[model samples]
Structure formats: structure tokens, C-alpha cells
Target: MDFLNKLKDITTFVFDVDGVLTDGSVFVSEETGEQTRAFNIKDGYALQLAVKLGYNVCAISGSRSKSAIHRLNSLGITEVFIGARDKTEKFKVYLEERHLKATNVLYMGDDIPDLGVIQMAGLPVCPADAAEEIKAVCEYVSPIPGGRGCARDVIEKVLKVQGKWMNAEAYSW
Candidate 1:
């Protein structure tokens, strides 16, 4: 199948948090021992828009950073899974709960941990700086690196192909 055809069938967006959402950099506060991650505003916009447009958006991560979870929640992604020890299992549960097929899901992951889930997705993608092993399996690799609009790049493409991007809903938020 063609790339556009794959995008057309995608009803859900599953992304890995650390390297996929942030730059894979963690800032640990020496005083409080708190770890935080940075997210791209453009990516946030795309995520919220996907939610508003009725697409299922989820974030899964092996990292247990509260700040990362908080950031994803703030963007209206309620299906956030932090501290996922077995991402493949989590992905299966998410699919079963939602009654969704793997062929209709877009999974973007950035590392070894995400390999299992990424392989199950219909359209697997990764950021430019993703591990070489990860890049090898992905059907699409964003030119933009992690935490630098990579999420936006894929989301925008899918939305645009589905005739959902830049509509009246996009103007407001």
C-alpha cells in the first residue's frame, strides 16, 4: 500500500514519551531530585488538535517521570502510560480495550524498548535521532529530531491526508 493510504486508515496515534516526545534529555534538579522533560509547543498543538478531532492519542514511556506524564496530560492525552515495563503488552491492552486493529494505528517510537510495539503498528515511524535498530524497522523516519517538531511532522501529515488538518477547528487551538 502507498503511504497516503496508510495515513488514511490511522485512527489512533501512539507515541513513546522520552525520545519521541522530548529530546531524550532529562534535567534532574540536584536540590529536589526531580526529573523534567521538555516538549515542543508545535507538537502539543498537533496532539490537542488530534484529540479535538476525535482521534485516539496515547503516550507510552518506560520513564516514570511525573513531569513528563503531567505534560502529556496537559495536552489532553489521557491514554498516557508512564513506567511501561513491557510496552508490547501495554500496546496490546490498549488495542483490546479500544477494540482497535493494529492496522489502523500509527505507532512512533525511538528506541529498543519500543521495537515490539512499533512493529505491530500499521505505520511505524521514528525521529531522525532514533536508534539505528529502530530506524531500520520504521516505515517512516521524521527528518526532525525528537523534541523538535517530529511529532508535529507526522501528525500534520496524517491529518492533512485525512482532510482534518487546518480546518475551522485548527484555527482556534
Candidate 2:
């Protein structure tokens, strides 16, 4: 399949945080007013493994949630772009800075704001619960929903295709 072929060349993984990672829900603290979002542990493991395997993993979000940023940082993702007004511009800069190519990137998004990068990425994917328009543009749509194992599903597929899954590195972490 075209999607499977694209996965073979994926050197980078770009995800939109709010919907693609957090299920599009935000909980505000009563006293501090700090926002929090829950992320799937399985997804976290896949992300960490991808990072360990030398894949370029990045999170671009329109939200300014500190907790979300912290979670990603703990996963060893150094390229976290929070509060990005225009995701397309940030994505371009990211690729240019790393000397990476668009055809080697797999971008997962769940909404309209993610349209630009999704259109440009070599492989565009979405979760089952993604917006209809976003799903329409995506090359693949995982059956898993966000804040679930959607990330894990896609990441596992890519790693498996590239023979990066089920290796010693994956066994350890």
C-alpha cells in the first residue's frame, strides 16, 4: 500500500498534541488554574522508543499547556513546539533546521489547524475520532482514538515496517 511504503522512509514523526495526543479535553485546576491532559502510556512508550532509535520526534501544539510540554519532555522529545499559532510555519522551520525532507516525515493530526502540514507531509494520518475533514485528507486512519493507543498503533506500524520494532532496544524500554 502507499501508506505502508511511506512508513518505510519515515525518519521523523510529527504529532498535533491537543486532539491527536490528548483526546481534545483539558482539565483546569481550581486553585492554580493549571491545565492538564491525559496521555496514553502505551503511546508514550512508542514515542520514547522512537526517540531512542534516533527518529526525529516532535510535538506541535496550538495549546500553551505546560503539563503537556512537560509530559513530552519526560518522553525525551526535545522538539516540543507549544503555543504555535501557525503549525505550518513551525513545521517548515523544523525541517529546515534539521536538514530533513518532507518526504521522510509522518505527520498525524486531528483538526483543521493541522491541515497545512498534513498536506505537505509524506504520510498523513489521523485517529479514528479525528475531524471528518482531517480524516478525508489523511492517507491512513488508526482505529484507536486519541488519548488511547492511536499513537502507539501508528508508531508500531512504522517501526515494524522498518524492522525497528521487537528489537533489543524495544525490549528494554
Candidate 3:
């Protein structure tokens, strides 16, 4: 309920890829030398739901991968930014491009690389298994861990508060 109030005004969600989206472990294909990441299907669904509800969802990560791009694109997220070293700067650019204010942003991250952007966001969030430093700065730490349903936890809270969760329109498929 507390988190719901904090997320009530959020219009955008920015996420860090490594520890927040994945389990912070990369599965490198020895045969093809391609990096693979495991993502949560529930998280993916929530992302699409956010987009369907007209909220901007973005991905900013230092590592780049083709599969990640394809996955996010499949969910209709066009603001995916992989190979991003300066997430805060990238986030600022996104805000300017969309004519949005920093105060309307929610950022979820889980490590040192994500600290700057997490601080810049109005509502900073982290997964349950996030680093101690990262968790310390978060406004809310999801009960679920990364690569699980962490994103779903937060998104559902916000949507439910706004009377969107479980609504017929929200479940439109």
C-alpha cells in the first residue's frame, strides 16, 4: 500500500539489465560465442502491460545482447538501450525526448552501475536480492528476487492502486 502511493504518479519505468532483469549471470554459448540472459516471463508480461497502459518502459544496461533486444522489442518496448555506461545521462535524454519530468520516473536497479540513475529517479526501487548498497537507496525492495517476479511485484502494486489491476481492460489479450 505504501508503494502504491509512491508509484501513483509514475509515468515511466527504467530498469538496469544485469542484476535487475536477469540473475546477474550470463550464459555464454561456447559454440557461437553469443551471450544469453534469462528473463522472467511475468516480468516481460508486466512490461507489455505497462506499455499497453501507455507508460514508457526502458532498459539501460552496460552489456549488449541481441536476444535481450528481441525480447524487449517483442513486448513493444522501443526505448531499449543496451551498452549504456551512463544510465543517468541516457535517462535524461529519454525524459527530454518524451517531454517528461524526472519526478514522474521510477527506476529499478541492483548494483553499483545502477546507482546514479537510481538516485535520479523519483521512485527508486530494487529487487530483494540486490546489493546492500543498492537496497539501502531504494524506496521499495521487492519481496521477490531478480530474474523472478520482482518487476511484476512493483508493476502490479502501481496498477492496482490506479484501479488497473485485475480490471477487464488490463487483462485484454
Candidate 4:
């Protein structure tokens, strides 16, 4: 499928946290109760672009981390789900609450937990570092690795396809 054509079906964007947002690393300091995670600046910029383009952005994860919340909040993202073991079920609920159809969503994931949601969405995306099984089923795979601008690349592809990239000013920062 052509990359741009896929964007016509997307209205919502869903992301996985661990591998998709962070580098799949957990840094925990027992002494200081501090945890740190690395995020891709390009990915953040892409998300800002999606928001400016009027797409609903959300993050879904089975892990609950304060760091995740802080990072997403800083980006002006409000739809976040933590500790969600059944992502597909949660996604259904999210669709119902938002009054959106399954065919209007784009889901990006890198692991097994993400499989269900990816299968259900209209457009399924995976990062370069995604597992082989995930890559096989995804509609698109980014050239960039996860947590290293993969998300941004996918967002840019979508925007470009939808003919909305030129109007997205939020990414100017």
C-alpha cells in the first residue's frame, strides 16, 4: 500500500510507551527513587504536528510510570492509558467514549501487547526495531528505530499523505 493513502483512513493516533516512546530501557535508582527514560525529540515534534493537524493523540501502555505521564503532559497530550493489559479492550472503550469508529484510528506498537490494537485499527504502524512478527503485520514500518524518531517519521508520512503537513505549525518548535 502507498504510505500516503493510509493516512486517509486515520483520525486518531495511538502509541505504545515502552519501546515506542522510550528506548525499551528502565532506569531505576533504588537510593534516590528516581527513574529516567530517554525520549526522541523528533517523535515529540511529530506528535505536536499531529495535534496541530487536528488529530486526536493517545498513548497506551501496560506499564504505569509517572515518568510517562510527565513526559506526555509536557507535550500537551491528555489521552493516556497506563497499566492496560488488554489494549484492544481499552481501545474499544476509547473509541466508544470518543464516538469514533475502528477504521478511523492509526495504532503504532512494537511488542506483543500491541498486537491486538494494531490488528483492530485502520492503519497499523511499527518502528524499525519492531519484532519480526509485528513488522510482518504492520501497514507501515518506519526507517528510524523506536524512541529515536520513528514515531515522528510515521506522523510525517501520515500528514504528508493527508495533505496536512504544510498546515501543521505546531511542529515549528
List the pairs of residues colliding in candidate 1.
none
Ranking by lDDT: 2, 1, 3, 4
Model 1, residue 157: distance off in Å is 0.3
Q: What TM-score would candidate 4 get against the native?
A: 0.92
Per-prediction TM-score, please?
A: 0.98, 0.98, 0.95, 0.92
* Tens-digit per-residue lDDT, 15-112, candidate 3: 88888878788998889899999999999889889988888899998888777898888888888898888887888898899898877888999998
Better of 3 and 4 by lDDT: 3
lDDT of 4 by residue, 1-173 (tens): 45566687788899999999887998988999787778888888888778766799999999888788888877778898998989999999999999998787888999888999989988899899999989999988888788998888877777777777866385375
Cα lDDT tens digits, model 2, 1-173, are 48788899999999999988888999989998988999989999999999999999999999998888899999999899999999999999999999999999999999999999999999999999999999999999999998798999999999999998999999866
Model 3 sits at a Cα RMSD from the real structure of 1.6
Name every residue pair that clashes in candidate 4. Answer: none
Candidate RMSDs in order? 0.7, 0.9, 1.6, 1.7
Question: Model 4: which ten-residue window has the lowest total lDDT?
Answer: 164-173
- Would you list the rank order by TM-score, best first? 1, 2, 3, 4
- Local lDDT at 146 for model 2: 86
CA displacement after TM-score superposition, residue 39 of candidate 1 (Å):
0.7
